[model samples]
Target: MKKHLILLLLWAVVGVSARAQKPATVTIPKNKYGLQVVSSTALYQQLVEQNPDQELVELATYIPGLVLDIKYATPDNLVKEPVYTMATAYARKPVADALKKIQEELKPLGLGLKIYDGYRPYHVTELFFKKVKKKAYVANPKNGSRHNRGCAMDLTLITLKDGKELEMPTPYDATVKQSHPDYPHVSEQVKKNRALLINTMQRHGFTVFHNEWWHYDFNEWPKYPLMDIRFEDLKAMKN
Candidate 1:
């Protein structure tokens, strides 16, 4: 009986040590609003393995000559503080492909898309809801913004030669009425510039947001899941 007990104790110790040697899997729980955000990089990788379209491609690297002005990464945004550690832009595979095509189309016109923001983390959206006063401009945390899904892009038109921004109705992230896509109080030059942006994005797979002239949502935004992955983690991901 003593020998049997000793062997059983050794077996238990071996089992415990084996379990301890294995890495623990991280699991993300639903947020207070009950939204199942993809916060785990492992889970995101698994999804990408299942569907190549689920991969979030870095926009700057994927799109040639793509100009990025990530406002959320600086203190210049509506939040008045830096929300992201890196000034980077990323989007789903399909969204990147569409943007690439759009860049190609705009080359002939001496205009290019300048991205202000893209692929916003879910936590940043929550922060924006708290800091932003205009409910119309900021997305509610309850329903997660399309930006959190890597499907929405905040951008404007820029000259390819001088890299200067085109005249638009309002500045990026403006909450004023003039920011509306159909706001008619602006000058003809602003109107023409806004129309050019809206029309070009519409010709592709993007639809302009009704309230924001610089914001565009991919037609397939519904397919991607809301993601809370940080930009640094995405950059660290192996190609």
Candidate 2:
């Protein structure tokens, strides 16, 4: 009788341990546009377990001295209202790593990056499509933006000493023709500043968006899945 009881207890302990070791299962749901977005924390964790590079890293913490000026977190964006709950930026592990190198390269030149946006949630891309006047400026929800993949960055150079913005062709988020990276009407100084930003980013495996001087897409963007996980949730996971 004593041997039977001990055996039963051991079996129970083994079963409980097996269950505890199993990862939580999560389902990724498709949106109205029939796109499967990784929205839940569990789903994101699963992906990270499979590929550590899939993790969304906070840029400010990952890249030392990285500045963030997330317009959508305030009322200054094209939406004219706050889209993000927090004024923070995130990108895939590799993207953040690349930006860290770019920051190091720029530091010696008395310049550094000021991020306007990064890792936009999928829902915000849908919202921008509905609100923005120019369709060209916003990504269609049917096909998610590179930003949703945590592989795109909207940024520009700033003077590291005083943190003053370096002059570009147009202000961030501008939809005018002058916003195009190759626009020729800008002053000589603005041209030089824009070229510096483009060249530096290009050297670091980023391609500048043709229509937006401040936007750059990581070459490996297509490898990352579209994500809609909120900034608050991502922050919680980090803790």
Candidate 3:
């Protein structure tokens, strides 16, 4: 009887300890738009483990001949601060897979994809809103950016030989009217380059944002949660 009692005691202790180790779920209060953000790494991991398709995957590992120039990791961005701790890009499984296809398509044409940003954390969006204080260029935290959902990408076309970026209507993250997809003031070559990019992405299940030539949303964006997991945490999980 004493042995059985000891086992029960041990079991109770173990159970309690396990429960304590589990990270508490982060409660994200809905913004005015009724969007619930996923701000906890634990919750994001649980969702991914439960449904592998929901995983935020590293782009370099998934795609070949892909160049990543994550601007948020540098001070060149509008925020004027390194918003991301690392210069890496991530996207959902389907988004990455689609990019891979796009890369393959561009290879024969001596062009490839150069990523500017992907999979932005929710907190970063809040920071951008606070800094920019305008909805014209920055996404309102009330409605988390598609990047927070790991379903958007900011990229430009680059030559495969010299890796030179093609001339677009405007630079990445430019907030000018020239950045508009239908802006008619651009030179013919710039127009051609922009058309090629928009057409290629559209053929591969991506829709270009009207204002940002570099930004594209994966058609399945609505299915994913707005994630705030950091790049370091995501890298640690892969290991």
Q: What are the Cα lDDT values of the candidates?
A: 0.91, 0.94, 0.89
Worst 10 residues of 3 by lDDT: 23-32
TM-scores vs. true structure, each candidate = 0.87, 0.88, 0.85
Candidate 1 on 73-155: residue-level lDDT in tens?
Answer: 89999989999999989999999999999999999999898999989999998999999988899899999999999999999
Between candidates 1 and 2, name the one with more favorable lDDT.
Answer: 2
Q: Tell me how candidate 2 scores on lDDT.
A: 0.94
Off by over 4 Å in 2: 1-28
**What is the C-alpha lDDT profile of model 2 across 126-148, one tens digit per residue?**
99999998999999999999999
Using alpha carbons, what is the TM-score of model 2? 0.88
Error of 1 at 49 (Å): 0.6
Question: How many steric clashes between backbone atoms does each model show?
Answer: 0, 0, 0
lDDT of 3 by residue, 179-211 (tens): 888999989999999999999999999999978
Q: How accurate is candidate 3 locally (lDDT)?
A: 0.89
